[model samples]
Target: MSFKNYAFYDKIMLSKPVTVKGLTFISVVGITIQAYGKYGVFLWSTITPKALIVVDSSGDISFYQISNDTATSELLESITLLFAEE
Candidate 1:
């Protein structure tokens, strides 16, 4: 897989300065998927026009043409199958 952007988070900028050492993974109201590197990719669900937002390591964002949520799942499954078939 390839990435188009990078994202960073800094807690020092906040007054609270929450500290958590080591590798940490947290999912809020949505889902967060980490690729092969130190970057994160999240899926956002919207209502108006059902879209799949892909955020890469360099802060580059991409929207794919997804008909619905089910379509997104199918696409991911298909991709997995493709690799499995190999």
Candidate 2:
């Protein structure tokens, strides 16, 4: 589960469950109070040697690589801030 890029969010259609650290999550339309609802909004993310961990506003976490080729400039900036070396 190595990542080619870091983590961020964009609107993507997921047809199956994405597993991260043994946790599984499915995509949902709109926001919901449920714990596993919504996988589109990326609130925070971190990179590790094995995976890129992403957490949404709903507290749902997923592991996957973010596609840099399709990422927006704004999202790229945010991701830069998150991973910037101090």
Find the candidate with the highest lDDT and give its number: 2
Evaluated at residue 57, the lDDT of candidate 1 is 49
After TM-score superposition, the amount by which residue 9's alpha carbon in candidate 2 deviates from its true location, in angstroms, is: 22
- For candidate 2, lDDT tens digit of each residue in 1-86? 33233333433233345766755654322111212214333244322222244556567765554454333444445445645643
Clash tally for model 1: 8
Would you give me the overall lDDT of model 1?
Answer: 0.37
- Cα displacement (angstroms), candidate 1, residue 4, comes to 46
- Go through the candidates in order and give the C-alpha RMSD of each one to the true structure: 18.4, 17.2
lDDT per residue for candidate 1 within 3-73, as digits (tens), equals 55333321111011222443222211122333233366653332233334454545465546434544656
Q: What lDDT would candidate 2 get against the real structure?
A: 0.40
Model 1 clashing residue pairs (backbone): 5-56, 5-57, 5-58, 5-59, 5-60, 6-57, 6-58, 6-59
Query: What lDDT score goes with residue 36 in model 2?
Result: 20
- Using TM-score as the measure, the top candidate is 1
